[model samples]
Target chain A: MLTEILHTLPQVLLDGLTLGAVYAIVALGYTMVYGILELINFAHGEIFMTGAFIGTAIFLTMTGLGVMSAMPALLALILVLVVTSVLTGVLGMGIERVAYRPLRKAPKLITLITAIGVSFLLQDLVRFIAELKKGNYIITGPSLFTNQVTVEASSLFSTFNNAQLKSSSIILIVTAIIMMFALDFFINRTKWGMAMRAVAQDRETAALMSVNVNKVISLTFFVGSALGGATGVLFAVQYGTIDPYIGFILGLKAFTAAVLGGIGNIRGAMFGGVLLGLLEMFAAANLSILSGGVLGGEYKDVFAFAILILVLIFKPEGIFGKAVTEKV
Target chain B: MNLLEVRNISLAFGGVKALNDVSFTIRKGEIFSLIGPNGAGKTSMLNCISGLYRPTEGSISFEGADITGMKPFKRAGLGIARAFQNIELFSHLTVLDNLMLGRHTKMKTGVLAGGFYWGRAQKEEIEHRKAVERVIDFLEIEDIRNIPVGRLAYGLKKRVEVGRALAMEPKLLLLDEPMAGMNAEEKEDMARFILDIHEEMGSTVVLIEHDMGVVMDLSDSVAVLDFGKLIGKGTPQEVQENPDVIKAYLGEEQFI
Candidate 1:
């Protein structure tokens, strides 16, 4: 049993990392929006799903025209990322303007209900469009990065087996890292970022600082949604299939990641995302063996939520939880 | 000409009147203090001037232009800056960053430019940092520039609050109870600092202070309010001698 665990450890970590990268990126949207507004944007997952659909559609069109495959994969990847990010960013801002902004002064519970409503609205809207176009809502997009690579861990250690992943996994990780670092720099060092921190702390006082509160709120939506949207594109490409409903479950998990790391802490969310991903993957590989077949891989999600419940019970502040109410 | 002209401003929430037909003028580069007992509408009048409360009846003109309906942020842009009665500093941020936030309106870097954070953005940031540093130097808070405000002593936090307003380089400064919770020594220090900010910065100051000693010593002009009504307005000495001001403070009773 020990040998079996060792043999699969490397493979699990590799696969887990790829999935974790997506979670960390998507969790950012939840954290960023929650930092300022304190409202869990339920539509965020839908935004990610929309990005996946849009990314796939654009990828299909580019390939259909015989251009996407002809371009370098990196350039092609960037093009999709930028286009989808802007579209989803705008959608997020529009969501805030039409749905969240009007209800901002209303009760928080009302805003939350409205968010769930928007989430359902987006799911149905995307479903209708996808079904009209392809006759099915679930899509299998053409792989832009299909090359596979295997890490030869067995050569270095006798018990460890080799781990394999497609070339898209590398792209996903590098992109996620770059995006994460960029966001970190923006929040910490930039003028607008400072203003964001101020507004998050005290909205009325921030206005007294001459920080345009409305514009700052709008920009927050744009950046957070843009990150989620781009992650959706990364998700569809790596997984090779997507549907409008993918966001609901994935978003809940990503939200779990956000809460596990302190909800408003940016760096905490990133660490939480990667940690959750690795844990989930590990559970999937070892749960049956560890439980003596009492549980199967199907219990991975339950394991994740159990951890959330435990954290909420024991350390409700979070894993790295300080007084994170105002920290950027 | 007066720097700020409040023309018959009245603010009412439903049936409760916070301010009623309150009018006053603040001259440029002078310290104008508003004094009254509690609920005298002194703070309400300040809120109206700062554009936090839109007076239901009248208009406010700053620098000779009407700003009655402008937003609070817009008023800040027009050189109106205020420190709250409570220390409203961003508690999580360092004192330097809190002061830097005062330069928010002066900054022009957009999201993309900010995200890049090099070249022009770096230069723009440093320039603003220099301005904030000057404020730090003047406030003598150089030692605590990097300290988080939430951890600071109460007196120091109050100074940082005023320093934040000073960083804006405002043409008109509004201070609401800047020395509300200070000890005698701290109050004396704040009073000196307030005078220095007025004299050296050349900024018009509108002060709301409960300390009569500080108000009498600091204000070039004084306005007394009772129940949202401006009962008297004159120099500190004249206001102190007025029958209306005496009645408002002494409650129409004989005093030794």
Candidate 2:
């Protein structure tokens, strides 16, 4: 059983990194909106789903137009990502303007309920558009970056097996890293970023400083949704098959990662995401063997939730969250 | 030079009058004080001027433009800066950042340039830093420039709040109790700062303060409010001599 665990570890790490990068990008969307507006942006998952379908739709069109054949897969993927992100960002802003902004003066609970309403609305809206266009809601986008490479680790160690990695996985991980660095730079070094932090600290005071609070909030949604949409394209390029429902579970898990890292901290969300992905993959690979066949790989979600509950009980501020301190 | 003209500003909240037909004019380059009992609509009048609260009736003209319906940020852009009675500094921000943010209206880097740190963003930041460093020098907060505002002592925090407003380079400065809850030393330091701000910076100041000594000493003009109505408007000595002002405020031994 130990050798079995050792043999599968390389492949698990490969898979875990790919999954973690996705969760990290998506968790960024949750954390950014939550940081500025104190809104959870419950429709974020649906926006992710919408981005996936839109990306697939764009790819299907590109393939039909023969653009995919003429251009490199990487270039086509980039094109799809840009277009899909812009569209979803606009959609996010529209949702904020029409659905959220009107209720700005309303109670907090009422605004949250409207967010749920927006989530359901986006899900159904995407559902019918997808079904009408494809005659089926489920889609498998045209393949790209299909090259697979194998690492020869068994030559050095007897217990370790060779790991297989897809070219798309490399692209996904690199893109995620580049995007994270760019966002970090944008937040820490820019005037807009300083204004964002100030607004998050105090909206009324921020306005007194001449920071346009509404414009900042709108731009935040645009950027957050844009990142979510871009990640959807990456997700589609890697996994190849998607549906309207993929966002619900994935978004919940990403939210878990956000909570695990401290919801409002950007770097914390990234760390939380990668950690959760590695832990979940580890459990998937080892749970059945360790449990003596009583528990299977399907209980991996249970294991993830167990981590969340434990964190809630023991370290509710999360790994990176600051504990509330009342001065003595 | 009348810098701010408040014409019959009345504000009511669901059948409760917070300010009623209160009107006053602030001249350029002088310290003006608003003295009132508790719940006497002093802060409410400032709110109306600063665009935080819209008066139910009347208009406010600043720098000769009617700013009665202007948004708060737009008001800030028109050279009106205010410090809060309660500290409103960004606690998570360092003292330098808190001051830099005060100059936000003057910094014009677009989001794309800001994100890319491309041409003009770097130059803009450097220029703004130079401008902000002047504020730090003027306020003498150079030592605490890198420390977060939340960790500062309360007196220092109040000073930084005024520093933030001064960073705006406002033609009119609205100070809501810059000396409240301070020791004699802190209050004297703040009064000296206010004097320097008026004498050197040459900005009009509108002050709301509870300490009669500070109000009497610092004010070129004093407006007395009671039950949301302005009862007297004159120099501090004249306001002290007015029968209505004496009967309403000074007669109370606790107030004096």
Candidate 3:
């Protein structure tokens, strides 16, 4: 039994890494926007789902037009990425302008409810559009990775199946890393980045120093939304499916990741995502041994939430987050 | 000619006029002070000048350009900078980081280059760091350079805030209640820093202060306000002798 478990370890680890990469990408959007605005942005998940659908639609249209060749397909994917990212970025800004901006000085609960409303609105709009296009709610995404690639390893480690690890996961991780590095550079090196940090640290003081407060807030939404879009496209590509409601659970998970890493901490979000992903995978693989029941396979979410609760109770600032104490 | 001009500026919240047709001008290299009893609109006037609040009427011109409705960042770009009444340093960031933020408007590196920490970005960052270090050393906060501003004591935090504004290297600097909530020693230290900033930097300084002693000693010229209106404007002794200014302070039993 021990040997069997060891055999499954490498595969489980691979699974965790791929899953964690996705969570980390999505969690970044949550953390960055929260860092600047202190808003939860509940509609971020829907924005991600929209990106996936947009990419799938582009791919499908290209295939239908007999342009399934690799070059054209890749070009089409790039187009989808640009289009989806721009669209979602604009949508995020729109949400801020239309829904959140007016309610900024309002109660936090009101802002939260407005976010929920925006989420529902986006979900339903996607569902309506899908129905109008295909008379079906489910949208099947293109499978970019169907060929199996096996890498042989020493007996000390379990054999790995590269095919099971989607190329989309690799792409997602690389893109997320690039984007984060870019964000860091923008925040630390550029004039705008300095303005953003200044605003985040102290809005009134930033204004007093002649930093444009509104522009910084709008830029925050744009960057956060663009990240959400990129994560969405990656999710659809990895899963080989897209649905109008895909963002629901994933959004909550990403939010949990943000909170776990320290909601307003950027690097913390990335770390939290990977940790949450690994924990979920481990719980799914091992929890079944004790219960010998259904809790092992599909009950990973329950375990994830349980971990989230425990983290909140024990270390609320998260692994890398600093606790804030205001001077009254 | 004045380098910065405020013309007939008035600001009201609801029905209460915070500032009413208030106007002033500061020449280059001058240390100007705005003094008043509590609620005399000294800070409000500074806010209007810094572009934090749009005047209900009238306009502000800096360097011969009309900047009445320009955004705050644009104003900062035009070489206007300020330190707040409350110490508003970025608590999570180091004192160096806070000062670097002040130098933000001067940075010319592109986002792509900066993100990758490439050649120009690296050079620019190093240059900014050196500049920030100069400010830090000038302020004598080198011991706490890497420590987060939040961890600093009140006096140190206030010093850091001043350091941040000085980093901007503004043509005109607005300081709101720079010595508020400070002990006598801290106030003396701050007063010395302000004098050094004026003499060494040669930047125009417009300050609001409740400490009459500091104002009397430091100001080249003083503007006095009472209930949103200008009651007096002159040298410290001239304003001190004005009956309206005296009545504005003495009539209120709270002025003890």
Candidate 4:
């Protein structure tokens, strides 16, 4: 067991990174919305699920039209990504306008309850759509690419001489990194991004500075949901199947990642996500050796939450979150 | 022509009349100060001009355009900038970012260009940075430019608030108690900055102040409000010597 653990460490790290990338992307939706409006946006997980469905629908349509067969694989994937992200972005905006906007000034409890209701509504809506299309509840996404594209890790990294890195994992990590940097630049450097931050800090001040508060909030939902949609498409591509219920646990975990990283901090979300992912992967992979064969891989899901509880019990502000001093 | 004209503006929250039939004109290139005792409707009048509060009745015009119905952001776009009495700086943001936010109306980059942060966005950001740097330099806050405003002292935060308003390059600058909570030295520095903003920057000014010494020394014209009514309006000497103004401040009237 010890020998097997030593041999599989590199693969576990790669798998952790791949999974971490998706969680980080999804976590952004929660963190961004929370930053601006102080709302949890519980339906955000549903937004992620919807993105996968939308991407699947687009892929299926393209295949039916014979475009997928004729087109280059990269271009087709890009097209799917763009379409799914845009559609999801719009859907996210709609959700904000319909469900969250009216409750902007309402009590926190009212907004929270609305968020949960919206989440359930989206899940049931997706399930109903799938029921109509397939005469059943579970909807499996089309296979857009090979499940595993193997690349000998020794050719790229001298340390992983015996490991074969999956191309999908590479794509996921690269894409997630690019998007994260893009988000960072947007929030820190851009005029709109500055407005978003200002609005997050103080809505009245942002308005005084000529920022349209409503517009900024709507754009936030759009951008955050877009990232979630992109992640959904990536998740479907990697897993090769999805359903209406997929976002339930994934979204909860992503929300946990947000809280673990410090809910309102962008960098915290990414850090928390990758950390959570790595911890989960390591715990799942090394359980037999670490726990003397008593604990099995079946308890893998428990590890993420257990670590979260332990870390949060000590550092409630989260690993990346600064301790906020409440002003009188 | 007047840079800002307030005609018969009144604001009431239920039965509480904050400003009643208040009328004033801020001429171009003049330092106009609004001074009054506490709950004297000074901030309420400022709120009306900045479009934070809709006047219960009356009209406000800037540069011959009616802005009574315009939104706060629209008022900002029309080149009206304000620094709040309570220091409403974005506390989490650095001084540079806070001032850059003031230049929001001046920036033309949209979401796509801003997200890319290349070409037009990069060029636009550099231009805005130069503008904000000028404000930081003028306020002498260059040392704290990169620090978050939350960690700053009271005087520095006030300076950053004014710096942010200055970054807008407003034609009409409304400052609400810009030197409210500062020490003597800080008050002097703020007075100098306000004078420089009026004289050197050529921006029209409307200020709300409680410091009698500062108000007398700095204002070209002063308007005094008492219990939501304009009780005095004149040059510093004239207002200081006005019977109603003296009565409102030192009178036996109950504090509302």
Candidate 5:
């Protein structure tokens, strides 16, 4: 077992990176929404699920039209990502308008409950739509590039045949990194981004500076949810199968990732996602050996939640979060 | 023509009148000051003009346009800027970003342009950064240009607040106790900046102040409020000589 572990460490790390990239992207949605309005957008997971369904629909439609192979599959993938992101962005804004905005001044707990209720509504809504269209609840995303060998590179770190890198993992990591870079630049450099940070810091003062507070808030939802949509497409591409229920546990983990990174901090979300992914993967792959077979891969999901509970207990602020002393 | 016209503006909360029948006109290129003791409605009057509060009665006009119903952000877009008494800076952001936000209306780049961050968006950003740089120079906040506003000293924080207002290039600048908690030397520095802003920037100034010396020296016209009533309005010397103004400041026992 030890010899097998030594041979597979690099592969496991790569797997973690791919999974971590998805969580990081989804975590951005949670963190950005929380940063602006200080509300845990529980329905965000459903928004992400909606993106996956949109991707599945687009892929199937393209396949039927013979456009799946007419152009490079990458272009179709990009189209799916962009279209789903935009649609999900609008959906996110609509959710905010309907469920969150009226409760903006209400107590925090009410908004939290509303967020959970929204999560259920979106899940059921997607299930209902799928049932109507396909006559079943489970949907498979159209296969693209899963069999193609885009790259065949020998493993340099380990002298093992099992360590050969896959093209799918490469694409996933590269695409996720590009999106992360774009998001970071947009938040830090743009004027509207600055307005977001300002509103996050103090809404009333940002409005006084002529920031159009509602517009900033609406844009926050747009950008965050759009990212969530993109994340859904990526998840579908990597995993090959998605259902309406996929976002539930994944969304919970993404939320955990956001809180793990530092809930309201942008960079923190990304860090938290990647770290959570690595931790889960590492624990699942190696924990049985490390613990003398006391814990196995079945306990993988348990590790992420345990980390979350530990973080909440030991350092509620998370890794990249600063402890703020609220002024009276 | 009056730069700001507050006509019969009355604000009340239940039975308590915060401002009552207060009418005043601030002419262009003049320094106007509002002075009164605690709970005397000086801050409330500023709030009414800045659209933070909707008055119970009367209308407010800016440049002859009735703006009594305008939203706070829209009012700001019309070149009216304000510095808060309690220093309402975006504490987590750097001084440069806070001041750049002061020019929020001047920046026209939307989210798409902002995301691209090239071509016209880059050019517009450079232009606005130049404007903010000029404000940074004018306020002499160069030493702490990149520091977060939350970490700055109180006097410096207040200066950044004023700088933020000036970044708007406002035609009408409302300063609410800009030097309320400053030391003697800081007050002197602030008073100089206010005078320079009035003369060089040519902004119409309305300030609420508790410092009598700074108020009397800097103001071209003074308005005194006592129990929500406008008891006096005139030149500094004229207000000084007014019996009602003296009574409001010194108390009835001193007059007796």
Candidate 6:
């Protein structure tokens, strides 16, 4: 029994890492936009979906037009990434401008409801548009990067096969790492980043410092949306298929990751995503023991949510979150 | 010539006049005080000047430029900074981080340069860090520099809030009830800080304060407000002797 558990350990670890990376990417969109605007961009999940659809559409179109060769595929993938990122980024900004900007000084509950409304609106719009052109429930696209380069398992771990690690997962993880580092640098080093942090800390004070609060808020929405777009594309590539409803569960999980990491803390989101992913994998692997049932295949989500609840109950600020205090 | 000029400013909230045709001017390097009883429109006037609230009538000009309809941030870009009556420090951030946020407007590196951490961005960040550090040291908050502002004491938090506004290096600084709710010792410390900020920095100050003694001691010019109207404006002694100023406080005492 121990050997069986040991044999599956590495695979669980791999699964966790992949899941965590995806959650981390999507959680960044939630955390960052939340940090700046102090409002949850409810439509962020839909934006992720939009990105997947855009990327899938672009890749399939390129393939149909005879641009499926390696070099051309790489170029087309880059084009798709850029276009999809811009489209989703703009969509994010539009949501902010139309749904959130005017309600800047409104009550928090009003804005929250508006955000929910926008989320449903985007979901319906995407569903309607997708229904018009699709016969298949899942849209399949050509792989943009699928060359498998396996790392051989050492003699000590002879039973394990490195071939199980997909090139797409590796690429996604690397991209996520690069994006996270880039985001950290942007937040810490750039002028606009400073403005964003300032606005987040105190909007009135930020304005008093001559930082254009509106422009900073808009830029925040754009960057957050762009990150969501990247995550969507990555998800599509990893799974080899894009479905309109892909964002629903992913969004909830990512949001859970954000809360786990500490909503307003960027570094927290990254760590939380990776940690949540690992936990989900471990639960999936040991479901029989955890659930005490013969069929434990579908308990991954239950386990993930269980972790979320436990964290909230014990460490509400999340693992890395700083406690907030008010001065009288 | 005055650096900040207010002309016939009036504001109303649902038929209640917060300010009625109020006018004032502040020159560079001057310590000006706006003193009034509670609900006498001191905060409303400051809000109007800071662009947080629009005046129902009249105009505001800074450095020979009309800023009546400009956004609060735009007004800030023209060298305006203010501290809130209720401390609004970013609770989760360190004192140094709060100060660094104050330097946001002065930073020059764009997102592209920031993303890569290239030459210009690095230089800019280092320079701003140095400036923020200076403010921290000046405020004598060096020990708590890395500690989150939320955990600081009320006095220290107020100091940090002042430090944040100072980091802006504004041409004009507005303090809303700087010593409100403070004990005598805290009030003295805050007063000294305010004086140092004015004398050493040579930035113009427009403060709204309720403490009569502190207001009289700190202000070079004093404006008195009684129910949204300018009852008196002159030296501290002049306002003290004004019968209308006495009546405003007298009426409040009787009602209470």
Strongest candidate by TM-score: 1
Q: Tell me the deviation in Å of residue B115 in model 6.
A: 3.2
Separate DockQ for every predicted complex = 0.86, 0.79, 0.49, 0.86, 0.82, 0.57
In the predicted model 2, the residue pairs found to clash are none
Chain B alone, candidate 5, TM-score of 0.97
Q: Write the per-residue lDDT of candidate 3 for residues A196-287, one digit (tens) a residue.
A: 77787778777766566887788788878887887788777778868888899888888888889999887888888888888777777767
Candidate 3 contains a number of clashing pairs equal to 2
Q: Write the per-residue lDDT of candidate 1 for residues B133-223, one digit (tens) a residue.
A: 9999998999999999999999999999999999999999999999998999999999999999999999999899999999999999999
Ranked by DockQ from best down, the candidates are 1, 4, 5, 2, 6, 3
What digit string (tens of lDDT, one per residue) describes model 3 on residues B1-256? 6998889999999999999998888788889999999998988898888777999999999988999998788888888888989777888777877888888777776545654677887888899889889899999999999898879999899999889899989888888998889999999999999999999988889989999999999999999999999989989999999999988988845645
Off by over 4 Å in 5: A1-4, A148-161, B254-256
Candidate 5 per-residue lDDT over residues A1-328, each given as its tens digit: 7776766576677788888998999999999999999999988888888998998899999999999979898888888889999999999999888889999999999999999999999999999999999999798877666764422223454443354445666787898899899989998989999999999988877878988888889999999899999888888888888888999999999999999999999999999999999888888888898888999988989999999999999999999899978779
Residue A204, candidate 3: C-alpha displacement in angstroms: 1.8
Tens-digit per-residue lDDT, A29-52, candidate 4:
999999999999889999999998
By DockQ, is 2 or 4 better?
A: 4
**For residues B1-256, what per-residue lDDT tens digits would candidate 4 score against the true structure?**
7899999999999999999999989889999999988999998888888889999999999999999999999899999999998989888889998999999999998889788888988899899899999888888888899999989999999999999999999999999999887889999999999999998899998989888999999989999999999998999999999999999889966779
Clashing pairs in 3: A210-B72, A210-B73
Best by lDDT: 1
Model 3, chain B only, scores a TM-score of 0.97
TM-score of chain B of each: 0.97, 0.96, 0.97, 0.97, 0.97, 0.96
Whichever of 2 and 3 has more DockQ, that candidate is: 2
Per-model lDDT: 0.92, 0.90, 0.82, 0.88, 0.90, 0.84
Name the lDDT value of residue B88 in candidate 1: 92
Q: Which stretches of candidate 3 lie over 4 Å from their true place?
A: A1-5, A65-83, A151-154, A157-168, A181-185, A188-190, A294-296, A326-328, B7-10, B14-17, B56-59, B63-69, B108-134, B181-189, B247-256
- How many Å off is the CA of A187 in candidate 2? 1.7
Error of 1 at A180 (Å): 0.9
**Shift in Å, residue A301, candidate 5:** 1.6
lDDT of 2 by residue, A1-328 (tens): 9999999998888898999898888998898888887788888988888999899999999899998899888888888888999999999899999988988888788888988888888888888998898888888999888889998878878889999999999999999999899889888788888888888879988988888999888888888898888888889889999988888888878888988999889998999989888889999999999999999999998988898899889998788988878869
Clashes per candidate, residues 3 or more apart or on different chains: 0, 0, 2, 0, 0, 0
**Candidate 2 lDDT score at position B28:** 86
* Per-residue alpha-carbon lDDT of candidate 6 for residues A1-328, written as tens digits (9 for 90 to 100): 4555556677678778988998998899999988887788777888899899888887877777776664565566667777988899999999999999999889888998998788788777777776777765577877657776555543458665343677788878888898899888787656777678878887876787778888888889998899899788888888887777888788888888999999989999999999999988888888876455664858889888888899899998888887766669
- Fnat per candidate, as a fraction, reads 0.91, 0.78, 0.54, 0.93, 0.78, 0.80
The TM-score that candidate 6 achieves is 0.88
Better of 1 and 3 by DockQ: 1
